[model samples]
Target: MFKLTLMPQNLEVHLPANSSLTELEFELHGQESISFGCRSGACGACVIEVMSGAEALGARAPCERNFLASLGFDGEQFRLACQCRLAGNAVVSAVAAPR
Candidate 1:
């Protein structure tokens, strides 16, 4: 199982390994702060900062790399929720671009 924490809001959810963050966001769509756009990973609307366990997000997709690079956000701490699938537990914060 994987433990996911949404920060500031401090919402925590448990999911199995290989679970999709997009699916989580979809299920919690009305939460307001946990936003999503272009679920295919082409947009940065769902960008998040990994507060801990960044490795749990698995590998970065090509679209995610391109978008993050274009935004000058070259680091492991930042990730697009749409492109992430949890491999372990992780704590993250919803953040805007240039993070």
Candidate 2:
């Protein structure tokens, strides 16, 4: 299992390894820890800062990579929660809405 910690709120969620982000999404539903829009990579509403254990997340898809790049975010720590899956424990913080 893996743990995902949402900062500020410090919400801790546990899930199986290689789990898709749906688990995290479900947990955050209706909460401001991270705001989700399209549930796909196109929207930046669910952006997050991977404070630690970035390896827990899978590689960025081409779509996600392009979107983040367009937003001027070039670091591995920046991610869209809607586009990420966790394979290990991770600590992340919700990013302010870009829109």
Candidate 3:
């Protein structure tokens, strides 16, 4: 199993290995803060700041890397929630991208 924390909101969620963050969002749908657009990882709307447990997240996909880079975000702590699948456990905070 894996643990996930949605910071600021201080929400905690437990998920089995190989679970996608998208499922979490769906479970918490209508919350406004974790909103996502373009589930394919093409848009930055789902980006989140990883507060810890970086190693637990699966490898960053190519599309995710390219999109973040295009947005001038090079830090490993930043990731698109839509592109991430928990491999172990992670703590992250939802962040809205600049318009």
Candidate 4:
């Protein structure tokens, strides 16, 4: 399982391998100020900043790349939480971008 740690609040959420980032976000819902929309990775509303353990998440998908491009998010540190699949273990922080 992977661990998602929210910064400042220090909240932690565990996600199993093969678990989608959308599922993890749901699991962590209501715990913090995180928000999600268009769970299919087209809205880019669930973008997050990988604080550490990026290796735990699966590689970026084509849809995710397109969405990020549409949102003008070119930084390598950003990821769409809905499109990422847990591969191992990771600690992530919510970016709280506009929907």
- Using TM-score, give the best candidate's number: 3
lDDT of 4 by residue, 46-83 (tens): 88888787877777877677677678776677888877
Where is model 2 poorest over a 10-residue stretch in terms of lDDT?
21-30
Q: Which RMSD values do the candidates have, in order?
A: 1.8, 2.0, 1.7, 2.3
TM-scores for candidates 1 onward, in order: 0.85, 0.84, 0.87, 0.81
Judge candidate 1 at residue 91 and give its lDDT: 94
lDDT minimum window of 10 residues, candidate 3: 25-34
User: What ranges in model 3 sit over 4 Å off?
Assistant: none
Model 1, runs deviating above 4 Å: none
1-99 in candidate 2: lDDT tens per residue? 888888989898888887766566576666656777788788787888899988788888877877887887767788988778888899999878553
The Cα error of candidate 2 at residue 62, in Å, is: 3.3
> Model 4 has how many clashing residue pairs?
0
- Where is the poorest 10-residue window by lDDT in model 4? 24-33
Candidate ordering by TM-score (highest first): 3, 1, 2, 4
Global lDDT of model 1: 0.81
Clash-forming residue pairs, model 4: none
- lDDT for position 49 in model 3: 87
lDDT of residue 70 for candidate 2: 84
Question: Alpha-carbon error at 74 in model 2, in Å?
Answer: 2.1
